[model samples]
Target: MPKSNTIPVVLTIAGSDSGGGAGIQADIKAISATGSYAASVITAITSQNTLGVLDILPIPLAHIESQLDAVFQDLNIVAVKIGMLADADIINLVADKLEQYQPKHIVLDTVMVATSGDLLLKETAIGSLKDRLLPLASIITPNLPEAAALTGLAEPKDAEQIEHMVTAMRQLSTSAVLLKGGHLEASDESDDLLITQNETHRLSTERIRTPNTHGTGCTLSSTIASFLAQGEDMLSAVSHAKQYITQAIGHADLLKVGQGRGPVDHFFMLHQ
Candidate 1:
């Protein structure tokens, strides 16, 4: 039997990237890189490369539930990172599991769109996410496009607008919202706005000029969950994760894994 205070375990509930750039692969890599024991429950499988997603095969809800039950029953999961929900049913299933296990920390990556501008989650699933999952999340990370979609905004142009959208999302969900500014058009820097019930924090970093930006959002959320599993507080975890991702992007390996875009090197720390 495992000891009471073994290595912190973190679970990732998301899709599978066949190319291993994003989704469950990226989540697992990020969790392991941050010194956490990684577990996963796959929601879907995609035949994809850095170029684009060609096909998506969603797993049955029963299988996802079984995977979740198996892990939570055996291991002591400290944190959870939720990504793509293939459909409304899957989203509901995940929500049920969260209510049952009640992990100490939960990071919700609102994975609606892909880096290649592909829609990952179904439109009908949004209602379920907003109603069931987001409320239970400790934090919800949404990129610009996804935030706009959730808030029904034409486009979020400035930081003020971003905060407004986040506030709107907060009204719909009980979790703190982190609105990512990477997708916004900017000449100088990238700004990510994190809004909670009590305060707002603005994190700014230089825009990384690279095409190897795949799996960034997934990496960020999972990294934050890993830090949380290590007993870091919420704001501290987010701040550390921001710095981690910034360094990861700056030192991104220039490997042409696929024809179009490529993944960042999660093992950059090992090489450094």
Candidate 2:
């Protein structure tokens, strides 16, 4: 194993969630919780809480590029987790930067909508995200809503439907797709499918019943990137990430930060 002091670094390129439940905040927390250093590039800012997003202000493209350059110049960023790029220009800029820096692993959470049903990504940018960013990702984690938007399919309601969506999404040329089934809340179990070019792994767990699932996607993807940065392969990284998210979600009700959907306990281990 690498020296303990040489912790792998994971960079998150995304938006700022002022509520601290999702976006860059969640990414940093999950990365740190999973034993990696975290760096961030905030492409946008959202005034949001567990209730919903009320406003969005996208950062300038030049500044986003500068943040990417600044982080890549010094830190040894082994993996990258990309969340909300709010527009077409931001998507192109991030894709260009990824082309330039060429991080070893890229986990793209196609963040289109929030947990409270607020749209975070511009519909106009979806085409650009597919054309530029999807091809570059090591894996793309799309929940039911995002998968439907990306693949032009209906939102999944079951494990079989989610797998079907993954099959459709693979045509977009992504090397891997982690189709998240968390939004199928009516089911007794959560099924996340990891579909790669050659294999498909079904990862199922008992669904934790709670409204405090805000930031779950960001947390999972960033944690997966962290594990990858720490030298775990794709399947192992995803499996470990699943375990981490389950634990986080199971402990989420312990936090009373919001009146509506609360956040997962990213530092649940510390709280023990």
Candidate 3:
């Protein structure tokens, strides 16, 4: 148990990544790294490693609802980070829970596919997410591919096209959209665009050359939610979270974990 004022509690509703690289595990680690208490309502369990997902066992909707109830009933949840919803029912369940609890901030990581190119959410879930979850999100973070999928656009090849895609995504979600540029090809810099109700801002960083980026998206979204839980405004929270993930990627240890791509060292800055 944490002191009432001391621990800022953040809840993550996502899948479990057995690789410990991404998903709920990464969310918890990122939350803790930012000095926030982490709680979880797991949507699915994956038999996966850095290489790929071998199997997926989705938790029943009832159980997921129970988990949400158990946490929100007791804890003062300050913020939420959502990831890896496996189906429409689960997405609706989460949306209903969010509506009931109304956490201060909601970071929606539109986790459509895995890093290894596996589709994580079902086809019907896509519609449910857009119709139900998008409006409730405080910030929706989608990588290039996911953004393209959500907006039904062919992948944008240039920054201008990417901006167009971001504009399209803004219409779908009432919240701020952070369209990540990790998968986009670039000559000089990797850039992420933040489009909100008020303005569109670009955040550029020197692209880190590393394969050890297994959980970067999950880590970044959770980091932002944690900062929001700690009372940072949306833009400042996102800015700091971007800086944190960049440093994590840069300092990623080349540990040959699982004989494939490895995870960013979330604990890297602490041990340094």
Instruction: In model 2, state the lDDT of residue 112.
Output: 92
lDDT of 2 by residue, 174-258 (tens): 8999988888888999988899877889899998999899999999999999999999999999999999999999999998888
TM-score ranking of the models: 2, 3, 1
Candidate that beats the other on lDDT, 1 or 3, i.e. the better one:
3
Worst lDDT window (10 residues) for model 3? 251-260
Clashes of each: 0, 0, 0
Model 3 error, position 268 (Å): 1.1
TM-score of each: 0.95, 0.97, 0.96
State residue 52's C-alpha deviation in candidate 2, in Å: 1.0
Output the number of the lDDT-best candidate: 2
> Which pairs, if any, clash in model 1?
none
lDDT of each prediction vs. the true structure?
A: 0.87, 0.93, 0.90
- Show model 1 residue runs off by greater than 4 Å: 1-5
